[model samples]
Target: MKEKYLSTRRTYRESVRPHDGEVRFQVAVEQTDLLIVAQEDLRHEIASFVFQVRGEIKNWILFHPEFAESLSPVIVDDGAPEIIRAMAQAAALCDVGPMAAVAGAVAQAVGDFFSPRTPNILVENGGDTYLHSTRERVVALLAEPDSGAVVGLGIEAEAFPVAVCASSATIGHSLSLGAGDLVAVRAQDARLADAAATALCNMLRSEADIASVLERAQILAEFGVEGVFAQYNKKIAAWGNVELVALN
Candidate 1:
């Protein structure tokens, strides 16, 4: 299995922090490195939740090794834990493996765990995020290396508790069959966003594939997908309510 590394760029988070009065912190454990933003510094609560969720996932994977290693969706029993079930659902939706949704699933679980206590919460696992904010938030896109582009999406405040997940073929250790530099998806939940991003990236083999990918992505809008953004060879394409903006 490929080891997961920290894929999220902190510069974007730092640039947008002033708009929201949320405190930011980091929690690292094994393969998981989470960048969390909340109303207050809740390191203890964050640590407890991360460990418990990670443990449950690790234990389930141990019992069902196929779930962790499969590149295709596997049937999960109803008796599985909520997180496990969520992973299965996301994988099935995108026709990918359950592990593809791991980061987003974990982020969503943590966000849900603290939603009642915090009015605004943002949890980023790798490049996948679970965001719930009272005000609009702009999440920057860190797509190519050494590129002079400052692209991002201006998510409306009404779109709170949405997931913005990214997948890349030129970056990170995740498995992808496409050549897209970055593919981001917005959904009602992080798990679906993460899985869909991976599935979309896998279809984008070249610049010519952008249109078809966008069409497929638009079909997901009915499934709570707010938008889709993809960049390849300096060419960018987007569909749905994606508020693209350039930062100074």
Candidate 2:
């Protein structure tokens, strides 16, 4: 199903600054809006590829309607597309619906498509991201945009080809069952990071839920989640491999 982009200003995009030797561009196909930073401007290619990925997922959902509507994992039939399988498996691991991983999955799929053609790529869809870099990088956190807060997650060069995805009840358009400001997850797979972020965000109904959710993040380490960061109102906490840093 096609979804429309929000007309409201995407202020968080202001934080996506391109580094030296990189180019930044935006691609919007139906509901999938991506901001890409790469070694070269590949907007045309990225747009075509992401459109194809969304088409495949849409066509697959036509046969398996539950794959798009299920709030829990759904097993795809044989001959499912790789992106569909990735979303399904990640959702199963994080106990979230496959759609929860759609943004990150699309972003990573684009990264995968261009990896061999480029040495560095960063794809951000909605707020979830798929990053591959040869040097250190920092991703801005938009937990409370109204408060003028500035913070980010620092990624070491060693964590290349990683996904840092976020879910929030107070930001963007993604659905959430909790009231937390934000919950970000890092994983080797963008789908897994996206699904886990949604799953963890669903567990946070209040600031009191922060400690318990960070503990839960540790358990998720068994399922490819390298780290997690959570914010609820003025409170913030993190666990595992997360490295919080100030952002200008």
TM-score of each: 0.92, 0.95
Worst 10 residues of 1 by lDDT: 1-10
Deviation from truth (RMSD, Å), model 1: 3.1
Q: Candidate 2: how large is its RMSD?
A: 3.4
Error of 2 at 105 (Å): 0.5
lDDT of 1 by residue, 1-248 (tens): 22233354544545545344678888877788888888888878888889999999999999999999998999999999999999999888788999999999999999988989987888888778888888888777768534433887888998788888999887777778887888999887898899899999998888999998899898776666789999887799999878998876
**Local distance difference test, candidate 2:** 0.87
Give the lDDT of residue 181 in candidate 2.
Answer: 83
> Model 1 segments beyond 4 Å from truth?
1-20, 147-149
- Give the per-residue lDDT digits (tens) of candidate 2, residues 44-108: 98889988999999999998899989999999866899999999999999898999999989989
Candidate topping lDDT: 2
How many residue-pair clashes does candidate 1 contain?
0
Candidate 2 clashes between residue pairs 3 or more apart in a chain or in different chains: none
